[model samples]
Target: MNPGRPATGGSTTTAVLGALAGAVLLVMVLVVAFPDWFAPYPPERTDLRAVLEGPSAAHPLGTDQLGRDVLSRLVDGARLSVLIAAAATAVGVLGGALIGLLSAAAGTRVDSLLMRAVDVLLAFPELLLALLVVAVLGSGAVNTALAIGIAAIPNYARLVRGQALVVLRSDYVEAARMLGVAPARYLVRHVLPNVSGPVVVLASIGTGTALITASGLSLFGLGPRPPQADWGAMVADGKDFLQLAWWVSVTPGAAIVLVVVVMTLVGRGLQMRVLR
Candidate 1:
C-alpha cells in the first residue's frame, strides 16, 4: 500500500531494455573504435578454404562468399555506418539549428519565406530527397552522408523554428528585448539555449534514421562501393547467396535493426526525462 513503491512490470521491462541497449551500444562503439581488438581477422582478408562456410569455433559468425570473416566485416561495416551517420547528423543538426534560429529571429517576413522553402523541401520524404541528391552528386560515403544530412534539414529546422518561436515570445525574451539587449546576444543567451533540448532529442533519434537511410542507399548502389564494408552493401552482396549463406546478409541486417531500436529507445527515454 506504499505509494512510493516502484511499478514492477513496465519498469522492469524498461530497465532490461535500457541495459541491453546500453550494452549493445558500448560493444558497437568499442568495435568501431578498435575493430582489430574484437575481430580475429582483418575484415577484408579472405581465406579461400573457408568460403561461404557456416559458423564454427574459428569463425563464430562464419565466412562470406568471398571467404572474408562475417564477424569482422560486420564490425567494420558498423564502424562505417556509425561514422557516416554521426557526421550526417552533425551536419543536419548544425545547419538545421542555424536556419531555424535565423527564421525565428528574422521577423514574420523572413520567417514566412524560410518556412515556405522548407515546406517545398518537406514535400518529399527524406529518403526520396536523399536519393535525388545522390543521383546528382554520385555515390560514396561522404556524398551519401551529405545527401542524408541535406534531406534531414527540414525536419530539424521546422522543429527548432517552432520551439524558437515559442521561446522568443516568452516574458523573459520580451523583457530582455525591452532592456536593449542586442539581437545576437539575446538569441545566443536565451533563444537557442531554451530550444536546444528538443533539437538534441530529435538529433539523437535522427542519427539512427540517417544510418538506416545511408544503408538503404548502399543497397541501391548509391553509397560506399565494395569491397569496402557497409551494412547495406553487405546485405546487397549477400542477396544473391541468401539461400546458401543466410548469415552473410542477415547478420548485418539484424545489427542495423538492433542499433536503430536502441537509438529510438534511448532517444525516447531522453525525451521523456528532458520534457519532464
Candidate 2:
C-alpha cells in the first residue's frame, strides 16, 4: 500500500536476481575451466552406435551427427562462449574507458578529434563492425573475441565520456578546481569513481552482446576449429543435421540462448541496483 514498500520490494527482487546470477556465473566458470567435471562424456568421444540419438537417460541431451555427447559439448563450449564474452567485455570497457576519460579530461581540440573517431565507429552496426574485424584478422576464437571487443569500444567510450562530463560539472569537482587541484589528479580521484557505476552496468550488458557476437562469428566458421567445442561451433555443426536429428544443433543453440538470457538478466539487475 505504501510507495516505500514497493521500492523496498523491488530492491529485494533485484538482490535475489543478483544472487542467482552470481551462482550461475560461478557454475559456468567451473564448467568452462574444467569441463570434464560436469560433462558426462568427453566432448570429442564419438560412438557410431549412438550417432544422432535423441534425448535418453544415458545421453541426456542426446548425441550429435558424429555421436559426440551434446551435453558434454555444451559444457566444453562454455569456455569459448563465456570466456570470450568476458574477455571482450574487459577489452571494450578498458579501451573505451581510457579513451573516454582522456577525451573528457583533455582540452576541446583533442576531445573533438577523439570523439570524432568514436563517432565514425558508432556509425556502423556493432555486428557489421565485428565482421569487418574478423574479415581482416581471419577466423579464430581469439580473433573473434578481439573483434567483438573492438566493435564494442565506441559505445562504451561515448557512455564514459558523458558520465565523466557530468561528474566534472559537479559541485565537488568545481570546489576542487577552485582549491587549485591538479586536473589529472582530480580527474582520476574524482571523476572516474563517480562515473564507474554506469560503466559496470554497461559492461555486464555488453558481455551478453559479445557472447552472441562470438557465437555468430563461430557460426560463420570463424571460431574454434573442429574438435574444439564452442557453442557457436556446436550450432554450426548441427545445422546440416537439423532435418535428420535436431538435437545436434538445438542443444548447443539452447545453451547459447540460456547463457545470454541469464547474463542479460543479471545486467538489468545490476543496472537497477547500481544506477538507482
Candidate 3:
C-alpha cells in the first residue's frame, strides 16, 4: 500500500461518520424544537390508572411512576436540556475565546501569567467547580447554565490559546507583524479565524458534557425545579420505584447516553476533519 493510504482511509472514515452524526443531530434538533409534535402525549399529563404501565402502543416507552408518558417526558426534556447546554457552551466559547485572545496577543510574560491562572481553574474537576459556582450563585436553570459555563471556561481557554499560539508563530503572521500590521487587525483577521475551527469542534463536545452536567444539577434540584420534565430529575424520581418499575429511570438515562454518544461522534468527526 502507498505510504499515504492510511491518511486517505482515515479521512474517508471521518467523512462518513460526520455525515451520520449530522443526520442524527438534525433529528435531535427537530425533536428539541418541536417536542410536542413528536411526543404522543403531553409530557406532564398523568393517569392514575395507567401509572407504571409497561410499554404499549399508547405509550411506547411506558408510563412513569406518576403515569406520565416516559417517551413524551424524554422528548420534552430535550428542549430544556439542549437549550441549557447550548447556552453554557456559548458562554464558555465566548468567554474563553476572549481570554485566550488576550493571552495570545499580549507579550510572553502576560501569556504566562494568564495561562497560569487558567491552569489553576483547570486544576479543579469541572463538575466540582460548577457545583461551587452554583452554590454561590444559587439554583435555577440560568444560574446552573452560568455555573457550568464558568467551569468550562478553562478548557476552552487552553484549547484556544494553544491554537492561537501556533497561528501567531506562523510565517505569514510574523511577516504581517514585521510589515507594520496593526495588532488588533491581524489578531482579528488571522488569529481569530484560525482558532475558530478548533473552538467550534471543542464546543460540539463541550455541549454534550454541558448537557450531562445540567442534568446532574437538575438531579440535585438546582435547576428548573419540580414539575418540569428534566432527564436527571426523571432518573432521580424513578429511583424509588427502580425495583418495581425500572423503565421509569432507564428510559431517560438511555436518552442521555444516546445524545452524549451522538455528540461525541460528531465532535470526533469534526476534530478529524479539522486536523486533515
Return the top candidate by lDDT: 1
Model 2: how far residue 242 lies from native, Å: 1.2
Better of 2 and 3 by TM-score: 3
Stretches > 4 Å off in candidate 1 = 1-8
What lDDT does each candidate get?
0.91, 0.87, 0.89
Which lDDT tens digits does candidate 1 get at residues 97-197? 99999999998899999999999999999999999999999998899999999999999999989999899989999999999999899899999899889
Name the weakest run of 10 consecutive residues (lDDT summed) in model 3. 2-11
Task: List per-candidate RMSD values in Å.
Answer: 1.7, 2.2, 2.3
The TM-score measured for candidate 2 stands at: 0.91
Q: Please, what are the lDDT tens digits per residue for candidate 2 over residues 1-276?
A: 775554577767868877887888788778888887889987889999999999999999999988888998898888768888998999899899999999998879999999999999999988899999989998877888889999999999999999998899899999999999999899889999988998998998888889888888888888767767888888888898899899888887887787777788877887877756
- TM per candidate: 0.95, 0.91, 0.92
Candidate with top TM-score is: 1
Sort by lDDT, top down from the best: 1, 3, 2
- In model 1, the Cα lDDT at residue 4 comes to 100
Q: Of models 1 and 3, which has the larger TM-score?
A: 1
The local distance difference test score of model 2 is 0.87
lDDT for 201 in candidate 1 is 87
